[model samples]
Target chain A: MKLTILGCYSATPRTDTNPTSQVLEINNHMFLIDCGEGTQVELRRNKIKFARIKHIFISHLHGDHFFGLVGLISTFRLLTRETELHIYCPKGLKEVITLQMKLADSWTNYQLIFHELTSTESELIFEDDKVQVFTIPLDHRVYTNGFLFKEKAGDRHLDMDAVLNANINVAYYRKLKQGYDVVNEDGVLIDNNKVTTDPNPPKSYAFCSDTAYNEAIIPIIKGVDVLYHESTFLDQHASLAPKTKHSTAKEAATIAKKAKVKTLVLGHFSTRYDNLNDFKSEAQTVFESVELADDGKTFNFD
Target chain B: MKLTILGCYSATPRTDTNPTSQVLEINNHMFLIDCGEGTQVELRRNKIKFARIKHIFISHLHGDHFFGLVGLISTFRLLTRETELHIYCPKGLKEVITLQMKLADSWTNYQLIFHELTSTESELIFEDDKVQVFTIPLDHRVYTNGFLFKEKAGDRHLDMDAVLNANINVAYYRKLKQGYDVVNEDGVLIDNNKVTTDPNPPKSYAFCSDTAYNEAIIPIIKGVDVLYHESTFLDQHASLAPKTKHSTAKEAATIAKKAKVKTLVLGHFSTRYDNLNDFKSEAQTVFESVELADDGKTFNFD
Candidate 1:
């Protein structure tokens, strides 16, 4: 799995810093999260193939979160893209996007499917054979949702030597990989655990942004492999965090510690501060494993 | 009068090139014309003050022309701008912009007034004591209107030598500047023309873009100080110009020559060409005065 930070700043986009947007690649899917203004250019700058972004997940309706959506959609039509695009966002996004298309009288040749989310509770929103996505209801000034992408556990690996010793046919290897006891060629049942070993551990990533330091989410994201949380303010401005419904570096670290996440990625930084080292330093004090996210940065997880 | 080419290209915005948008500073007003996507950044790059842009004129509803408008409006609100903003665009733009504002639940603190244009003929859209703006009807796929910013004829410059010689009193100098025959101290009526000359010849600028090579607008913009016409294609691709409702460089030069304008600025270039000097060369063949519009380039017209 890999994560690319297209933009990680809060508020408006600047020449050097961009607003919230990222690409998470897992289970053969490239999911675009929170497309802020100027995201299309960022995508081009990062050299990410536009066609690979099949699904888009918006965290909120703020201009910094989803303002670039309509322009990207219109550009897709201009490029003559025929792949069906799916948008999972808040309820009002469909109306906002369709209105512009109607006014331009330029509809996309491909299908545009919208999964308007209104539920405030964490729910399963998308699932496939290899992965599942769940919305982590977040606390914010407006309706917001963070997404958790978890890879499903794979089949157990068969021990070829053990299967051969049991006189098992090649056809029975499939059953053994499925963790089932198989009948051998000698007409005796072979135990599944004796012939098969466990497969590689599944990895999961959770993206939580634009939310306050709420401890209630710790239970839902416990033991996640990687956790990306919004730390809009530093400890110096800790007082402003609660008032603005945004998290400070210390607060995000606390959540990561309580959730016992393997790695904590801090992003959505406020542009008021000149240096980003304070964020990582402050987060590391509370959580041992902490990383800072910057525009055009990429992280690899194995 | 000064014109700043914020973005001057055709079709979609690229990493290096932008779509159609320009800033025309006439009299005291810094009027923004045709705000394409990424225009706010271009404005920042060009060091234009956000507060000075009180009026925005959109040529059409095409995405390349007006997609950046809503984002700019939202950024103003985020900056806590309290000045009222006036937008003059085609009829359907108001609904498209207001709908997004409603969905984001972010109404501007400042008043947003919309002047929707449904006219197919040239008409006055904006005016003040120093300047006047009129629509330049153009041929495009959509209902489009380019703008003609004309400096209203100023008070005639008083010939102080001529006025003093005629024994005119200081109090009646104001009347002479108003281009009126004044009664001198000797109770003699003096001719206005004998004491005053025309003021700066009333400079005018016409912006015509995203249109085909049509001569109907020549009479309306005849003998204007500076004329900006779209030249989306070169002569080699002249066959595509008529089909796409865009003009070639040679065609633009033809229009400029027929209109007899002081200077002709060519813009809205297609991205297919790597060399821009050819456009100047091709246009100079038909018109003596030709200038190419490039992003971040500024032109001074006097």
Candidate 2:
């Protein structure tokens, strides 16, 4: 799995830093997170294939979080895309987007579907053969939710030589790979553990942003491999963070530590400070494995 | 009066060429016309003082025409503007901007006024002491209207020598400048025309974009000093012009000729043509004074 940081600023888009948005790639799927203003331009700059993006998750209704969404959708229509497009966002998004489309009398030819997420619970929103997506309810000023992407454990690795030495039928190799023991034609029993190795452990990633420090989401992202949390402010601005329902770097690190995530990626730095080294250093104090997210940096999980 | 072509290339916003948008300065007022995507960055690139812009005019509801409006508005709010903002757009624009504001819960301290236009006939939408703005009803798929900004004829310019020779009192100097000649202290009668001349001919500029080659607006914008018209396609795509409700360079020049506009500035070129010499040559066939609008090029009428 690989994740790319397209934009990670807070409050507004500046000449230097952008607002909240990122792209997470799990196997063959490309999922867009947050989608702030100017995201399409950033996507083009990063050389990401925007058409390959099939799913988009919007954390909240903030303009910095999803203002470029209308433009992106309009561009997709102009490109003559026929593939189905899925947008997971709050309920009022349909009214906002559809109104513009109605006024312009332009409609997309593709299957533009909206999976409205209003429930404040860990409900599974998407599931496929290899991946599953669940909502991690968060505390914020508005209707906001985080996403947890988990890759399901796959089939076991089979030792073909061991299976053949046990006199098992060649047709039963598929069953052994599925962690099942098979009986041989010679009335010999083959042990599954002897022939098959355990499956690779599944990896998971969780995304949280534009929300205050909340421990309620910890249970949903308990065993995540990597958690990207928004650190809009530092400890010095902690007073303003709660009033605005945004988290500071130290608060984000504390949440990540309490969630017991393997690693933490901090982003969404406020524009007040020119330097960002303080954010990384503050988060690293609580979370041992912490990295600051940049505009175009890509992270790979092995 | 001066006009600056910020961007004019049609279709999607590429790295080199931008979509439709421009800036016009008339009588000490900066008017932002049609904010395409990345317009603020373009404004910064051109070194145009954004704070001087108190009015923004959107031609239509097309994505390329006003996709950058929201971002520009947000940036102004971030800058903590104390000046009131006025947007003259289609009727549906209020809902779109208000919805985004509602979601973010960030209202501007300065008053934001929206003058929605829905008329099919020409009508004055804005008028100050020096300039008047009128909407030229357009024929398109959506509710569209072009703007005609005309610097109202001011009081006659006072010829200093003529005024001194007429022996007009200093208190009546204002009245003399307004072309009302008064009797001198010597009881000599002075003609108003002899004392003053026309006030710089009152320059005018008309911005017509994203519309077909309709002759109805010719009478509305007749005898304008400079006319910035959209020429989305060349003569080769003339057949697509009327059908799409767009214009060719030749068509725009023809309209300029019919309206007797002083100078014609052709812009909003289609992205299909690599070379723009054909548009200039085609427009020259119908109008003698014609120039292609290049991004960042400024035209001064003095």
* Each prediction's DockQ against the real complex: 0.61, 0.54
Candidate 1 lDDT tens digits, B257-286: 999999999999988899998999999999
Error of 2 at B171 (Å): 1.8
Cα lDDT tens digits, model 2, A1-302, are 89999899876675567788899999678999988777887888888887899999998887788987988898889889889999999888988889889888899999999999889888999999889999988888888999999998888998878877788888998898788878987987787999889988888999998789998988999979999999999899899988989999999999989999999999988889888899999888888889889888899987
Candidate 1 is scored at a TM of 0.94
Each model's C-alpha lDDT? 0.91, 0.87
lDDT of 1 by residue, A1-302 (tens): 99999999998877688899999999789999999888898899899999999999999998889988888998888889999999999998998888778777789999999999999889999999888999999998888999999999988998888888999999877778778998899999888999899987988999999899988788889999999999999988999999989999999999999999999999999999999999999998999899999999999998
Model 1 regions lying over 4 Å from their true place: A157-177, A181-197, B159-169, B181-197
Error of 1 at B139 (Å): 2.0
lDDT of 1: 0.91
RMSD of every candidate to native, in Å, equals 2.4, 2.3
| Superposition error at A27 for model 2 (Å) | 2.0
Question: Which residue window of length 10 is worst by lDDT in model 1 chain A?
Answer: A97-106
After the best TM-score superposition of candidate 1, give how far the Cα of residue B28 lies from its true spot, in angstroms: 1.6
Model 2 Cα lDDT, one tens digit per residue, B106-204: 777778899998889889999999999999888777989999998887888888997888787777778877878688778887788898888778888
